[model samples]
Target: MAIPPGFLDELRNRVSVSEIVGKRVKLVKKGREHSGLCPFHNE
Candidate 1:
C-alpha cells in the first residue's frame, strides 16, 4: 500500500524529533538540533 501525499509532512509537523528519540535516548540541545550517543553501537 502506498501512503497518501502530505501525510508524512503533516505528521512530522505535529510531532518532533526530540520527543520521539528522547523516549529511548538521552538527548542534549545543540543549537537547532539534538545530540546523543548511539543506542545500538558502542561509541
Candidate 2:
C-alpha cells in the first residue's frame, strides 16, 4: 500500500499534537503513533 505525503513526512520525527489537534489525523494503525508524548513543548 501507498502512504500519504504528510503522513510519511511527519513520521521522520515524532507525532505532534499541535499538528494533529489542528487537523484531521486518521491513524491507519492503532497505538503505533502514541509517540513519546505530545510533541508541542520541548519540556
Q: Highest lDDT: which candidate?
A: 1
lDDT of 1 by residue, 1-43 (tens): 9999999999999999799999999999999999999999988
**Global CA lDDT of candidate 2, please?**
0.54
Best by TM-score: 1
- Using all chains and alpha carbons, the TM-scores for the candidates as numbered come to 0.75, 0.26
Candidate 2 regions off by >4 Å? 15-43
lDDT scores in order:
0.94, 0.54
Displacement of residue 28 (Cα, Å) in model 1 is 0.9
